[model samples]
Target: MVLSYEPSVKSRIMVCITPQKSSRRLVERGAQRAKETNGEFCVVYVNKNSDISQDLKENEVLLELFDMAQKLGGRVSILVGKKISKTLAEFARENNITEIIVGKSLRSALDVILHGDVVNPLKKEAMKNNIRVEVIE
Candidate 1:
């Protein structure tokens, strides 16, 4: 019996999004990349416990992401986990994602202290997983 082999090249990328306006830019970029590479796309969102509701019609952010994915011609997935970076990276690996799209954060002392848990760990783990992470400045 002959076996067909599939390449491991990452055709799909996962982008982490929040309520921030920059997410729109990332979505656009992800869409372009997906189109150029002829690869499927997926979007991941991490929100707080109280933020989620069963109303996409009323939830603008969720709706926006879905719309972008649809327009970009890719698949979309939303994840509700507290750990942002860890969850994102795990998702990329799980879905055989090769790249990640993220927006750059304005540097602030308070922001660093608070978000170090997510940013620092994410950078290190992405390298370990052999995933390419793109931070839009």
Candidate 2:
């Protein structure tokens, strides 16, 4: 009998988070997927505006979430950009992220129509980079 060993591909999973408590779930989910695949986990928060002081409460919550991500063996990143989807996609490409986990969009239909849908653009970007995206409801 002969024994053979094959190295598995390592995945780099990124979780896109907001400054809300619900974002913790996304982080946990990303961590679980990373663990299952023996991959790396990362949590990212994108601020549309540079003025984080505009929302002190949200900033505090984000800090807590970052702490949790660190405890879960995940790297935490805070980015400032005008476009969320584009920023996330660029980060994914630069980081060689294999998969991205995001929560269902909280934007209203009107807002989406006026601003643009994050998931759709993100999905398009992911396709171009051969990256997978999971939207958790």
Best by TM-score: 2
What TM-score against the true fold does each predicted structure earn?
0.80, 0.87
RMSD of each: 5.2, 7.2
Worst 10 residues of 2 by lDDT: 1-10
Candidate 2 C-alpha error for residue 129, in Å: 0.7
Model 1 per-residue lDDT tens digits across residues 1-137: 11111364346766766665568888888888877776666766765464566545466877777787777775666666677777777777666777788877766879778766565677778888887788887
Model 1 clash pairs are none
Error of 1 at 48 (Å): 3.0
Q: Write the per-residue lDDT of candidate 2 for residues 46-68, one digit (tens) a residue.
A: 88888866754547888899899
State the lDDT at 25 in candidate 1: 85
Model 2 ranges with Cα > 4 A deviation: 1-9, 53-58
